[model samples]
Every structure is written in C-alpha cells, then in structure tokens.
Target: MAAPTPIDQITDKVERLLLRHEELQRTNALLVEQVHALQAERDSLKSRLMAARARIDALLERLPGASADERKERT
Candidate 1:
C-alpha cells in the first residue's frame, strides 16, 4: 500500500478543519438562542420585581403613621 503524500495530508487536515468550523457554528447558534431566552426571562423578572415593589409601597402608604418622610428614612 502507498503511504499518503504531503498533498493528501494537507487535504485531510483541511477537511477536518472544515468539519470543526461547521460544528462550532452550530454550537454558537445554540448559545445565541440561549442568550436571547435568558435576556427575555431577566426582563420579565425585572418587571415582576417592579410590580411587587409598587404594591409594597402602596400597602405601606395605607399604614397608620407611615409618613412619606418616614418611608424615605427607612429606605
């Protein structure tokens, strides 16, 4: 059997690199999708937190002797 020539070695390496490049591209796309999903989740959580804070503020306002200045000092 004939041994592989230099050209054959180079071609084989190039093919392997191309395959690796394709695999990396697929992995990068999946990571991007995950980042987008996480960003949306983070935004939703921030909105929920803001709503909860508003409700707490409202409840505090209804409490007796809970003056605006007192609230500011507590914070």
Candidate 2:
C-alpha cells in the first residue's frame, strides 16, 4: 500500500473535525430542547403550587375564629 500524502492527511483530519462538529451540534440542540421542556414543567409546577396555596389560604379564612388555638384544639 502507498503511504498517504500530506494533502490526504489534511483532508482526512478536516473530515473528522467536520463530523465531530456536526455531532456536537446535534447534541447541543437536544440539550436545548430538554431544557425547554424542563422549564415548561417547572412553570407548571409553580402554578399548581400557587393555586394550592391560594386554596389553603381561602380555606383557612373560612375556618371559625381562624386562630392557632382553634387549630390546635381541632388537631
């Protein structure tokens, strides 16, 4: 087999680098998509938590006397 010329070596190296760059680009895109999904999930959870807290507050307000003493006695 003939030894590869310098140009051949450079071309091969360039092809490998291009392939690596393309792979990294794909991985970065996937990570970004995952982050977007996670952010949406976090927002949903925050909204749910806020709604539950509001409901609890409303329930507390409806409680008779709305006092720690009444809560302790009920417990």
State which candidate has the highest lDDT.
1
Give the per-residue lDDT digits (tens) of candidate 1, residues 1-75: 899999999999999999999999999999999999999999999999999999988888888987899987775
Q: Write the per-residue lDDT of candidate 2 for residues 1-75, one digit (tens) a residue.
A: 999999999999999999999999999999999999999999999999999978876787688755876755554
Question: Which candidate gets the maximum TM-score versus the true structure?
Answer: 1
lDDT of candidate 2?
Answer: 0.89
Worst 10 residues of 1 by lDDT: 66-75
Clash pairs for candidate 1: none
TM, every model: 0.94, 0.83
The stretch of ten residues in a row with the least summed lDDT in candidate 2 is 66-75
Error of 1 at 3 (Å): 1.4
